[model samples]
Structures are given as structure tokens and as C-alpha cells.
Target: MTKLKTVVAMAAASALFLAACGSGDSSGSGGSYKLSFVQGVTGDAFYITMGCAVQEEAKKEGATVDIQGPQKFDPTQQTPVLQSVVSSRPDAILIAPTDVSAMQRPIEQATKQNIKVVLVDTTLNDPSIAASAIASDNVGGGKAAFEAIKQLAPQGGKVLVVSVQPGISTTDARAKGFQDAVKADSKFTDLGVQYSQNEPQKAAQIVTAALQKDPDIVGIFAANLFSAEGSATGVRQANKQDQVKIVGFDAGPDQVKALQDGTVQALVAQQPGKIGQVGVQQAIKALKGEKTETKVQTGFTIVTKDNLDSPEGKAALYKSSC
Candidate 1:
């Protein structure tokens, strides 16, 4: 063949090779994969950071990712959003389920469609639907939050736990951890775990009631961001800032501000970004027919006034943006 004709033939062959490689497939191809990340709630710093991390990691893997969630952390609201995600038929889904049992059917349905599922940050009742679950050691973090409270109020008095409503695995675990820790310590008397349903106002009401019942309440553990915010508000409202030691979960902006202003003594900060990163990583692996750890435990840090300005503490701070 002429030199010009040979060059054209080589160019055509190269185009065909690239096309074959770029063909989207679940069988270990490096081509783009469709992924969806369903947050338990939108506009929350933890979920925002998780979404950012998932997008960042998906970019590296050439996967297209969409992050969607309910306006609030309600399973009824989240189920429709999840159904929409499933209808899109993405190759994989990484989700933070609002309820363990409520979300089971939807997640199992996705699995039935042959979509790989990775539970991020929170889990469902039937984890068998998920290929992997990546989240902070919530139980350990809860125990740590109580430990901080103990350090603050060593002479143990009545303590209250403000938590998101029942059925949220993460907060439930944290509450349990706090209860177990309290049970192990005779110094602290448990006031009871109050459900806020992720509403700050409800949490504040509970805290105020607890304070009314036992004005000598020494400490409080807020199980998540909204609960922490409400607990702080309650403490401020009751004018018990100096009297009540408050340890909270998640270092969101409000929680960090509370820590700085002495409303909250310490915060159990979960590595939500790390959870998202691992969720995407596991999803990719599962899609590629590679083995993945069914349970991946991310970590947490305790942020306090002492370390709020430190490098490690700053790293634990949550970001509102991707």
C-alpha cells in the first residue's frame, strides 16, 4: 500500500481500538460507569462532604456519579428518591439509608436489578442487599463522646442523650454506645435518650424538659448534628452553659461553633469524606468482579477546645461544599 494509505489504515485501526476500550461494560473495563450516591439528607455538611469525596474518587475511576437525597432525613422521603435513582439503572449505588427496615425493600430491589450497592455512613436492617457498608465506628465514637463528658463532669450527675429518632442506625449505635458506657460507670445517672427526629426544636424541647426535671444534670450527649445544635440551644436557653457539660456527635459548623463558644465541650467527628471515598472504591471493585470488604470501618476524632486549632482537629472539620 502507498505510504498515505498505510497511515490512514493505521489511524482507523487506532480509532477502533479506542472505541472497544471505551465501550461501557461492567466486566472490568476502564470505561465510564454510572454511579449514584443517595444521601440520607441533603444540605448537611456530612453528606455534602461525602458527596464531594465520592465525586472526586469517581473521577479517578472514570465513573459518572450523581448525588441525590431527601430534603430531610425521613425514610418516606428518601424512598422515592432512591426509587428514582434505581429507575436510572446506574451500575452502582452508594447510600446512607434513613431507616434500617424502611429502606430494606428498595435497596434489595436495586440488588435484584444487578446493581452493586454500597452502604455509606448508615446501614439498613438487611445488610445483605449491600455489597459493602462503609461508615465511622459510631459505637466507638459514642463511647468516646460519653468518655469526654465523664472527664468534664467527673462527679457524675444526671446526664441526657439527645438523638435523632429511632431507626437511624448511626445515631442508634451512638446512643447505645453512650448508654453502655454510662451503665459501666456508676457515677453518671442516665436521664434517658430523647428522640429529635433530626429536628433541632424537638431536641431543644427534650433538653429543656430534662433540665426542668433534674436541674442538676451534669452532662449531655447529642447524638448527631441537629441534635447537638438543639442541645446547645437548650443549654443556652436554660442558662446552664457553665453547669452542664455537653458532648456532641459530628463536627458540623454549628457543632464546631458550639465547641468554640463553650456550649459543647467536645465533638465526636466522623470521617464522612473517608466513608464516601471508600464507598466508591468498593463499588468500583464490586463492579469489576473484584472482592471487597463487606464491612469497612472508617474512623472518628474527638474535637475539643484544646485541639480545635490543631492540624488533626482542623482536618476533622466538616465542609459545606464539594
Candidate 2:
């Protein structure tokens, strides 16, 4: 009888342990709701900060949020992660798609399964697949970037933009914004944009070539972090730090450091954490059959050396981890 009692007690304890483990899966106060946030790149500070905010915000709404992403910011790398997330059949998905066109089909699959999709940071080609698109105003960021360049190069000479691959919504908007902003003023000569394909070395090569071609180039706008890093390196290598005005996008640690050291004069910083927080909030709302906003345009912060340590500047910084 004592052996029987011991066996029964062990079985009960095992059951309790199993239940505890399953609690985190999908069981919440208002029933189970699972949210998955796919980052553009796992190691990227912007995406990490965004993922952290999404996880915390989802918890507040009694939902379990999972973070998934590729090691590299490539559409092919992201596709498998998206497919896996869909297979999990989460209540909602918040994703930063690598490419505008490549992500459309994967997002469509999620929508077909009734999974609420909230696009964060980046967007897809077809906006209809998403319940809501929450991101910084990339065009505005781009315009701000050029305005900084204008201030640096008051006389306005030849200016270049180092950008990532084409068809990536955020960078594309930024490039367009810069171009349009330049068009309004005839003083600044547009030297044309160079595609980096998210490769820093390639961006560096492009910048080096541009500098060699246009030694009189007055300003450079780097559309993303990698491009900015490469541009800074290129400018420093060419010994044109004083002559070239470098304006960068995304206040990642490297960019902030660049700003501090005068590698980049200014940064058009996106509110990635806010975007993530809002993305999860909107996803939860969609799951609850609430009216979610079709578009949520989070604004950007212009960070410079003067205000680098200020509260606002600190807010603009990105974290590598939650």
C-alpha cells in the first residue's frame, strides 16, 4: 500500500510539472493567444530592442510572444522562419520583412490561416495582407538626413547615398526622400545612390569608388546601419572626414559611436522599440476582434553629438539584447 501511495504521489508531481511547462505555451487568462515577432536579424540591435518590447507588451495583454529571425538580413533566410512561424499557427505575427516582394507570399499564407499579421519596421509589397503596418516614417527620416547634409554643406556640392538592396521598403523610402529633398534645392548636386545589398564591405567599396570618382562630393547619406558603417570607413580611409558630410540612419551602437567620434555628423533614428510595442498591441487587438489601425507611422528622432547623452538621445539608442 505504501509503494502504491508513493507511485501515486510521483505521478501527481509529474502531472503538475507538465502543467507548469504547458502554462507558458498558449494558456492565458482570456484563453490562449500566442504572438510571434520576427526580427529582421537576430543580432541587430534595432530588431533586438523591438523584439524585447514586443515580448513585454504581449505579456501585459496575457499573450505569449516568441521572437524569431534569421542570423543575416536576407529574404531567403527570413522565408523559412516565416514558414515555421506560420506552421506554429500563432494567434498573430509581427514581422520585419527583408524584402518587399519576397515576403508577400509568406505573409499571405499567414493571413489565410487567420493569423493576424502586423508589419513592423519593414513592409511587404502588398499592404492588404497585414492587419496593421507599424514603422518609422522612412521618407521623413530620409528627408531629415538630407537636411542635415544641407546644414553641413551649406554651399551644397555633389552628394551621394549609400543604400541597401532595392525593393526593401524602409531603405527605398529613405533614398527616395533624400532624392526628393535634394530636388527641391538646386544647390546640392545629386551624385546618385549606390546599392550595397546589405554588405558592409561592398558599401565600403562603393563609397571608396564614389570618393575617387567625385573628389568634390560634399555629403553622403547612408540609408542603413551597414551602409553607414562602410561609408564612415570609406571616408576615413580616404582622409575626407572634414571635407565630406556624413549623415547616417539608425542609431545603433555603431552609429552612436560614429556620431560621438564625428564619423557621422547626425543620425535619423527610428523608434524601433516603440514600433515593436505597438505591433504587439495591434496584434492583440486584432485577435480580440478590436478595431486596429491600418497604419501606425512612428516618427524618428534626429540624434547628434550635442544631444548624444540627453534623455531624448538615450531614447533613440538601440539595445543589443532585452
| TM-score list, all predictions | 0.92, 0.90
- In order, what lDDT does every prediction score? 0.84, 0.81
Local accuracy of candidate 2 as per-residue lDDT tens digits, 291-316: 67777888777788777777877888
Candidate 1 displacement at residue 152 in angstroms: 0.5
- Candidate 2 wrongly placed segments (more than 4 Å): 1-29
Task: List pairs with backbone clashes in candidate 1.
Answer: 100-125
lDDT of model 1, residue 317: 90
- What's the lDDT of the predicted structure labeled candidate 1? 0.84
Candidate 1, 65-124: lDDT as tens digits = 999999999989999999999999898999999999999998898887888899998998
Clashes of 2: 0
Off by over 4 Å in 1: 1-24
